[model samples]
Target: MSDSQKPASDPRYPDIRHVAEARRLRSQGALIIDALGGIILCPLDTSRADLRILDSATADGHLLTLIRKQLAHPESAELIGTDIADYPPLDLPENITLEKQDILKPWPEKWEAHFDFVHQRTGLAVTGGMERAVETVRRFIELVKPGGWIQLVDGTLIDHKIAEDDKAWVKLFKVLSQCVTLVGLDTSLGVSTAEILKRAGEGLVRNIGEKQGVSPLGKGASSKELEELGYVELKGMHSGFVTMLKGMPEDKRPTALEQVEGLLPEVLREAQAGECEMRWYAAWGQKI
Candidate 1:
């Protein structure tokens, strides 16, 4: 489908910016350190090397920014950021370049077999189908040079249990998941990464690491800060998702937004109550 034909209210589009910021913070905090260390310890020679990096479905160059700032292989490295629509307004370092392309489509003409590292995060639900999305990712692996790395990070909305069972929060999560699923996407694609990679014929797989934690509610707590930022992002996402649904003949946009608004207070209350927890997963592997 053409970009304009797609609804402006799509949650995938709205969450792009907020998700980028969250990744930026996480990269600077602990994630980047681990990624860099992993790259350094890889079996590749660091000296006299040529590296090309691709950030597939890069929302706002969050991961690219972190890599440019941290990696020492500047001369040998080139970075490309791809997205479905227009690239977000991100200030990238000189080493990075932005390209307007959809991950669902084939790799751009100039990028075939050009990357040494392919990194992507959070696109399973944004793309139209899970298998199609995995196929695109497999094509991304084809674009990488031999003995390269492919890293992916995403989370499922499962197990978002609350101690007190706040109805509002539960309703919101369920509705959000349902809306996205209606478009042929899965919110919980993280659990399937290993299997997808294997299906893509990628070998020498290594389970880098995985992390799980509860999203907090207070400002000082880690998960709380994420929720606060995520709430702000949700306003835009809700508007976008509602707008998309309104375009449908059977969907009612006004009622959707009204329900979303009604749920907000309860979501915020649950956030404050420290009663909810969100689980996340991250992993990486190599192509033989």
Candidate 2:
């Protein structure tokens, strides 16, 4: 159901799967970050009391927190987080409603043109392939009210900045990309969310916008917080790491896997020491 790694056994690890992802997304969501309410709803009549928002495919509900930032009061919004799995304990569990949903199935009839805003990030992994991902985006746009807002965020799996000599991680990244492709998922789909929505949305969506940024990790990092975030992110990719390695040429798989596994600890150290960077992106639009 996901490409990102699940929670690590370490109790102290933050719920963030990738700090680079959280950073770029939070920055893009700042327009409605303060939760002052009615600001984003400015497009609607001020007297309209109903304001509903949804964060589909949420796991830990971080993006839902960003969506909640726009509400003035708990009751002023109907916030829902939808996923096939159980909702994990959120930072503010009481603030939003959680729903059990399988996006591959048809969207509920009640959800049609129902939300004031819809937010999602790095969610296509749930679709298992690009065609279903495209369908999910189409349904996501359709769920928004006319003149409502929506935002989608995703990241590149192979996007990284490392020392010229850091060919090992780069090689691992290529393997990861191939692994994802062999399974029918687009490794770089996150960078294309805006374009996908723009093309599929056509007359239904307007004011389409997208922006991207690069974040430093490890030894190239300017701060410890960023560095730690990078380390955590790399750790989260471990499962995909294993999967990608196993997908390599059968003859080389065993040796390559062993080599990459041994170097990961140092690779993490490289990020903490300011030696690496990751790229992420976001796309948003208004439902017209």
lDDT of 1 by residue, 2-100 (tens): 433343344455433344444443433233233233323234333434567787766566567666554567655788887665533556677787776
Off by over 4 Å in 2: 1-50, 125-132, 159-166, 220-222, 243-256
Q: What tens digits encode model 2's per-residue C-alpha lDDT throughout 82-106?
A: 8654433546647577776766678
Candidate 1 residue-wise lDDT at 217: 33
Candidates in order have lDDT scores of: 0.56, 0.60
User: Residue 170, candidate 1: how far off, in angstroms?
Assistant: 2.4
Give the lowest summed-lDDT range of ten residues in model 2: 30-39
CA lDDT, candidate 1, residue 210: 42
